[model samples]
Target chain A: MIEFLNSIQNSLIYKNFFLVLSGLDNTILLLLISLPVGFVLALLFALGRVSKIALLSRTIASYIFVIRGTPLLVQIYLIYFGLGSVKFIRESFLWYALKEPFWCGVIALTINTVAYGAEIFRGGIQSIEKSQVESGLSLGFGKFLLLRKIILPIALRKVLPSYGNELILMVKATSLVSLTTYMEMTGIARKIMAKTFAPVEAFIAAGILYLFLNFLMVQFVKYLEWKYNPHLRLNN
Target chain B: MFKFDKLVFGDAGWGDEFLIATLMTLLVSILSMGLGLFLAIITVWAKLIQNKITRFIANFYTTVIRGVPELLVIYLIFFGGNAVVMSIAKVFGYNKYIELNALTIATIAIAVISATYSSEVLRASYLTISKGQIEAARALGMNKFSIFFKVISPQVIRHALPGIGNVWQITLKDTSLISVTGLVEIMRQSRISSNVEHSPLTFLITAAILYLCLTTISSRVFKTLELNYSKGFST
Candidate 1:
């Protein structure tokens, strides 16, 4: 049984298991670091979109437009190889972080997801009934305070489900970092495939990892939905 | 700060290459999107079918395709496809390399991903249809094929337009990943131009702008289609 299990074709998984698992560290790091930063930025953008200032809202809207319109891959290349090549940026203090391919990827992923998440948040914010805002206004709450206290709480909760999809998207998107030579899951998988000459099996392993990650994210979203909105919960 | 010296037409510039690449991106995206919509309908049908195996396959297809990254999907189709072709040729005793075209592989990859997403949209739109409509169709003695053509499809289009529009935008942007397979799309064109001009930022910015134009215009078309399809439906 052991001999049968140790066949040449079957050795692919056990052989490079640790090498591939190391890649997950980068992938998880990308997800962990970028997501919080993206959430804050997405919220700010969403607020700016709803703000009364025409110039501010318009600027934020265009920023979101540009981000959404471009491919995440192109955005990564623009930041890593494109912006990273600039003389001024290279000379600046920002070069410390920009010099790393992984950081470039995080920057791209954060910006891309912020555009998408901001849209989802904007939809959530806009869906808030006028009566709620008017009540806050009538209660003498300042605009910023109301937004910080009430609007954000409700809007963020309302959009949690939609935002969950964005989370899964970001998780999958971390795979693109591999293109920048970041040793994420996809990158490691690619190397293994080349060495083993078994592209399908390599992809299957990576694909399974991604699916597992996304499945966890989906469950996380469901838990959030259940936790945050208790009324929607089913009681035994 | 960004140079446009390499953007102008003639021997001095890559303006022609950029134009051709943009067209290629559009062509590939359109081809994949059309095929994806067809596949999505089939997937939706499979999911809706009562057969256990068909439903499981359809569900698995959507779930796995959605869960995995586009890069992986593209790589698998590109390399695995070549491997399959080579193995088949070996089986035929030819003993030679047989590779699939990059364009075909890229299109298939994007088509597959888009189909899963669009299938959900299509399925949701179909399910939104009230049970009464189908019951009425049956009462009218219409067969299954006739019922779908005469009843379900028109309503599905009306409800599915906005979602389909979103899928189109995603599909259009996904064509950018095909550049990795050397499909000569906008992203690859920018890479080549940037290398030649030694100004990656300018060419990339130009590429971003072209994509912006495509996205904005297609969105407008979809908005119009949504309006047209929704006509006579009570808001």
Candidate 2:
């Protein structure tokens, strides 16, 4: 225990908080870009999954199955290393996107999250009664108007709890972006550890930062839940 | 673009190594699952004890571990574990440098992460057991051990099986992340084979297929267990 304390006192994590904080931008950037894109794609795929067309639903089902079945690390490696190794891909105009590890990490993270997020969205959408859609049509609401005014708003609210869980998971998952050699918080912690030989302190520093980030997120989700469900609040 | 012959056994191909590596991955995963369950039982016990400090500690373990990225946990164990272990060893009057094997390190790191999740499953399962059932068991003059063995455990196992199955799948997939510690698990082995064969696409897709099979098969197995345990009872 004393060793743990002494190591903390002697380490760079305590003395260099700003250096550790520097990696926060990359971590937040990855989340900001991927989460919205993933949610949008997830909603589209979830719609496809529930569509009347068998082929479209079946295709989306298989895609989600394969993506959810495999590890995100393998998916990341597949995008970063596997796709990059193909000769034509390397030589083609697509290399601009594939060459950067940050983009590769983003692509993999988005793909993986979309699969899980799609399932949540599907559940939320499915919970809505078919009567609601029919009623909207009877009232002369156009398809897109109905979606924007009713379907999306209700579905998004229904999925907020699960979406919050996914948000936390994704925040934690951004740490894996370090595997592609991207300088996220975890990657920065690794670099700092390598330089100072203080692995425990560096990791603790990173862990604390993630905990703080998720704490804020959880509170925001809680506030949203409270705001949107005033009837439930009144009952309590 | 495809070559099945490269997966042939013996020194002529990397197939044999891949098989062994797959087994290694399974071995680590199964070991970590068992260890995680043990820790989870203790964590749940601590929570149930109703002592403020113990409950707080248990909550801290689950919340902090779950919040942090798992890769960070593995990295801390891979590097910091050696020094911590050496220091404890020194207290036991050993002077030689003691390095933790990659297998042990991987198992411990993954087990710590797995325990936090499994504990949540288990605690909920325990909570699902009705308070009346325990009182009824006591009213029957059943001993504590007998009541726990007969009334509590059967219900807990049945309720918790599906959740544990999810945790088991997560643990299995999390093993691939430990490949960063230079363990010759399926992921690391795939990297080696891909580099040697210069066909990353083929090898990685093979790895993905292997994972898909493992997940599907194990999920089926969990389904069977759930069914059998649920046999004679209806909800």
Candidate 3:
């Protein structure tokens, strides 16, 4: 075991593994920024879908459908190359953000996650029993008060598991930003592969880093689930 | 300034190329989903077994595969897979670079990822099958295999179809990643065309449309199956 550790330490890929792991800084940044922005956008989309106005609801529904049906890779490329190719966009204030791979990735991911997150939110809100709403109203709860006190809390708890799944999916999805030439986890692996021609070693190291990150995220989400939903506890 | 004529099928058009790539995407997605279903059955079986070692192995497989990104898995299979095969062959005195076509690697990689999710779905469906039903099948002198096939499997399929449909949608989108492996799928074809034509928006929008078509058609098919299976019973 000591010899194996020494061998690994002596290898070029292992020596450079920390440099490659540094690419996950962008991955972490993407997650932190996109999740909250996506969540707010998702709330709007979900509300629009469930709103009384037919035009607003239909427009949001179609937008969700388009976003949901497409792949995130295509979406990223479209925003990066497609929008970046436009003359007006290049000249516009948005050029600074759209031209950079990092912001482009964040935008594309946020848009894609909004579609999915909205659907999950809509499902959770809809799943609430009608009697619950009626009871809240009978207790003289106003629309805003009812949404704040009864609806959002229950809906949030119900959607936590699926939302957690979406968060994990977003983390995985950030790997694609490497293709945009951003030095994320997968990007660094590609760089090492290009230099060392040791795709196996470099990719294994990268995969381990990703697995560790995801494991931590999953455990954190599990802790949140435990804390939020006491009714799900086993005889506690 | 967009040229609609270039999108038409002809000597001066990319319509034929797009159509061919669309077919390739469909073929890969269908093949992966089929293979994934087979793997899911085995995985769910392993998970269900009442053995400590088997359960641990199953958990490790699903957790690691699910935790990592699909792109890394594909790259690992494409690179590490060949190295493993070559090293194994070396013991037999056959030393050569064993090359796997992108289609095979992509199919296997996507199937492996899909199987993890599908196994979870299948396990959940299996759990929903009442224990009394299995006991009753045994009470009728049914063999284990017969009970599984004739009694339990159909209901499991009925319960698992929607979940399987969701997995298929994911698989369909995931085949785009195979473009990195040089597969001539829709995404790759669009990339080539856009690079050549200098019309990234046009080709990508076309690819997105092709994807929307595939998803729309498959969702319809799944809905039909769901209706057919639940014909007599009301949800």
Candidate 4:
């Protein structure tokens, strides 16, 4: 056992151990950039889906359908390689952001999650009772005020569980960013494996990190659920 | 002249290659879904019987498969599966290298991942079968097999159609991961085309359209099935 421990400690694979420890920076950066952009896009898409205008609703529906139909990896490839191939993108001012694998991955993941979250939010909005809107209007609330005070809050609460699931899925989906050469946990692990010839150990360590992150996400979602639904609170 | 004509039918065109890859993708997905359905039936049966050990095993399978990301599962199978297979083959006195096809391994990986979702859908449908109906069928001297086929199967299919449709979609999307195994699926073909042609946008967009075509058609068919099934029920 001591020999085994010593072997592991001395191996080049230990670089991956260090890489995994430092990989939290990439993961947090990905989440911070993608989440808010995804949320805003989701909201707009949701509103488009629920819009009274036929063209608006159809356009958003088609966008959601196409995004949901294709795999996230394909979207990433398209954004990273496909978009990057265009001379315009390369020559334009946006090239600085587009050139980076991290931003490319963020753009792809954000767009993909927005498609899913929009559908969930649309469902939540549609499920809201007509009586709630009636009450808001009866109270002389303006359209924006009514939506802010009544519609948006209720819809948000209703979609929170599905949104939580989407967030966790986004976390898992971020692993695909490694394919774009963004040195996230999986990328670092793959690099370590290539150098150290320890595929199993590198992947196992990366898997554990993912599992831990997912567990944290689940706990956070549960807390949010409880916090939002305080009326269900009973004697502890 | 050769360049322009070759652009239409050449190795670089990927026109033929893309079609073949799409066919392979469909083949793998269909085979995996079939395997998943067969496994799901047995799992649903075990769960339905309420045996303690069986229940524990079934629950464990679902938890692990669903809790972990599909990519990890695929990676585990891709990297470790061959070694296990070769060892078993060795015990049988096989002298030659026992080669496992990438398509077969991909099918197995996808089927295993899909079976978790399929089993849950089947289990839920199994439960939705009215207890009284089963008891009545038994009281009427119907055997277990007869009860299962004549009474349970149709209802379960009808009720589970939408959920099963979802499983089909999940399986279809999951086929993209098989590209990592070096299988010439649409994604892989597109990637190759992108690298060779240096026109990643064109090929990627084509691949996306192919996916959209497959999914849109299947979704429409499933919607039709849903409508047909719901026709008997009143509003």
Candidate 5:
């Protein structure tokens, strides 16, 4: 039985499975670093969309539209090869950060997800009943303070489910990091397939990893929604 | 700044190549979207069926397809499909290897992903039809097919227009990933031009402009459809 198990473990399928699994760290890192960065930017963009200044709101809306309309792959390529080729960018202080493929991947993923997450957040903010805002204003809360103390808390809860989908999308978008030569899960799978010519097995393993990660994210978001919305739970 | 002349029609320009690639992207996306709609109809039917196993399988299909990265799905279908076909051929006493066209593989991959989203949208649209309406149609002795055509489909299309528009936008962008499989779509053509010209920024930006155009036009078309469908309804 030990010999039989050893033979199974020593097979190419098992070897490639574990090899692809080893790259999960890069994938996780991309998701963790980009998501928080994206969340901050998304909140800002969402706020900008609803700002009193027409120019700021219009500019932010156009930024959201352009980003949404283009492909993430094109954006990734534009940041990496396109920006990297510019002599001005090379000489600038930003080059130190932009020179690396990992950072490029993070920047692309964060910016793309911000476009999506911002829209969701804007919807959440807009969905707040007008009467609630008026009551807060009548209670002597300043606009910024009202947003900080009252509006955001409620809006964030409303945005959780949609934001969860955006989170999953970012996780998927990270797979495109391979195009920039960064070794994430999909990158590792591609390498394994190239060397062994067994793309089926390699990609299947990678797909399973992605599916598992997304499942966890979905569950976590659901838990947050449940915990945050006590009123709905009590009513039920 | 790059020379604008290089983008114009000439032997030194990529205008013709870029135009061809744009058409390729449109063709592949349209075909896949049609396939996705067909698949979604079947998936929705399976989900709405009164059997536990079918529902479970349908649920599993959508969850897995939607949850996984589309690039991985593309890779899986391209390579895994070849393997599966080769193995099946071997079992049939055929020794030759089989090669599937990258475009077909890409269309199937994108269609599978699009179908999951389409199914969810279609299912939601179907649910919006009042149950009483269906029962009333049945009470009038209308068959399932007649009830679906006369009652359900029009409303579903009206309700599903926006969601389907969202799906089309996603599908259009996703055709970019098919470039990895060597389809000479806009993204792939742009990459080639960029590499040859050593001006990655210019080519990529141009590609982005073309993509933006495609999406903007389609969104307008979908808006028209939505307006036409919601004609009598108040805003």
Candidate 6:
């Protein structure tokens, strides 16, 4: 059994197992860049969706509709290749940033997640009881203050579970960054598989990494959920 | 203003290729949705009526499929499908290289993803059916299969149509990912055109617009289905 284990470990394919460990950096970087940007955009788009003004609401609706309707792969291709084709963008100061696959991927992922997150937030906002808004008004709160103190907090708390799912999705979606030439986990896995001809081991490793990230995200979201749930805390 | 001239039938434009690709996209999406719906029915039935083992199997299927990214699922199927098929064939003493077509691969991938959503919808619809109604049917001497078709199935379809429509749209959008496997769907065709013409913006924009068109038409159809299904149930 010890000899068998040594043989498994000594396989030429397993020699570079540590290379996959370095891939976690790219994975973490992609998540760190995309998540906060996605959150801000989601907030703006959600506000636009629930805005009183017809034009603001309609424009946001169209943006959300179009983005949600299309596949993220097409969006990535369009931003990376399509936007890159424009002479203005090519010549602009932003060209340097756009040239990097990392930034390009972050841009695509941020846009896709914003669209989904906005919808989730909008649903949460819509589901908020009108009596709460009335109470906020009775407390002499203006629209902005009410949104800040009451509406936004409740909406965000309510939407946290779904947003947690979205976060996990973004972790997995970062695999597509490989298409843009960013050597994230899946990208590295593909390379390793190509060299060693062991697709199952490489892919299985990548899948485990993804599952691990998702498991962490689930735990983090659960902590946030517990922290925010006043009723549960009061009982405890 | 957008002009139809570029979209008109001619060799100079993408009109013919786009049309053909759109058809292919629809074909793939419909085939996948049909397969998913069939799988979902069995899964829902298994989860609802079968033993604990069957229920566990059904739950495991849904949980794994839903938890993973659709892209990963597609990749797994794309790479592994042919090998698995060939191995199965070899066991039967048929060792010739049987090429799994791109459409079949895409259909299976998308169907596997769609089945999770479809099964969820079916299970929800099943739960929404009143238990008393089933008991009444049984009391009236209706067998399980007979009662299921005559009562439960129609109502479930009616209730599940909107959810199913959402799944269809999702499947439609996901077909764009099949380009990775070299399928000549709209997205793939557009990518080819973009590369050849060096006009990525125009081609990608056109592709996005075509997708919007498909989704908008589908939303309308789903709305009509919802209305039609609600006619008798609502005042």
Alpha carbon lDDT at B121, candidate 5: 97
lDDT of 1 by residue, B102-154 (tens): 88888888999899989999999999999999999999999999999989999
TM-score of 1: 0.94
- After TM-score superposition, the amount by which residue A28's alpha carbon in candidate 5 deviates from its true location, in angstroms, is 1.6
What candidate 3 gets wrong by more than 4 Å, as runs, is A1-4, A234-236, B91-93
Q: Which stretches of candidate 1 lie over 4 Å from their true place?
A: A1-10, A137-145, B85-97
- In what order do the candidates fall by DockQ, top score first? 5, 1, 2, 3, 6, 4
C-alpha DockQ of every model: 0.84, 0.80, 0.79, 0.48, 0.88, 0.51
Error of 4 at B145 (Å): 2.3
Preferred candidate (DockQ higher): 1 or 5: 5
Can you tell me which runs of candidate 2 are displaced by over 4 Å? A1-11, A130-142
Q: Candidate 6 lDDT, tens digit per residue, B76-148?
A: 7887778889999999999999989999999999999899889999899989999999999999999989998
Task: For residues A44-161, write the lDDT of model 5, one tens digit per residue.
Answer: 9999999899999999999899999999999999999999989999999989979999999999999898889889999999999989899999999998899987899999999898
lDDT of 4 by residue, B1-235 (tens): 0123223455657778878989998999999999999889988877878699998898778766766667767876777677778889889988677778899899999999999999989888888888999999999999989998999998998889999998999899889988988999999998887788778888888888889888989999999999998886837
lDDT of 1: 0.90
List the pairs of residues colliding in candidate 3.
none
In terms of DockQ, which candidate is stronger, 5 or 6? 5
lDDT of 5 at B15: 93
Better of 1 and 3 by DockQ: 1
Tell me the deviation in Å of residue B16 in model 1: 1.4
User: Considering every candidate listed, which one attains the maximal DockQ?
Assistant: 5
Count of backbone collisions in candidate 3: 0
The alpha-carbon deviation from the true structure for residue A229 of candidate 3, after best TM-score superposition, in angstroms, is 2.1
Provide the overall lDDT of each model, using Cα atoms, as 2-decimal numbers: 0.90, 0.91, 0.91, 0.86, 0.92, 0.86
Q: For model 6, how does the per-residue alpha-carbon lDDT over A74-164 read when each residue is reduced to its tens digit? A: 8888888888988899999988988888999999999999999999999999999999999999999998999999999999999999899
Q: Return the clash pairs for model 4, or none.
A: none
Lowest lDDT sum, 10 consecutive residues, model 5 chain B, at B1-10
Q: Give the local distance difference test score of model 2.
A: 0.91
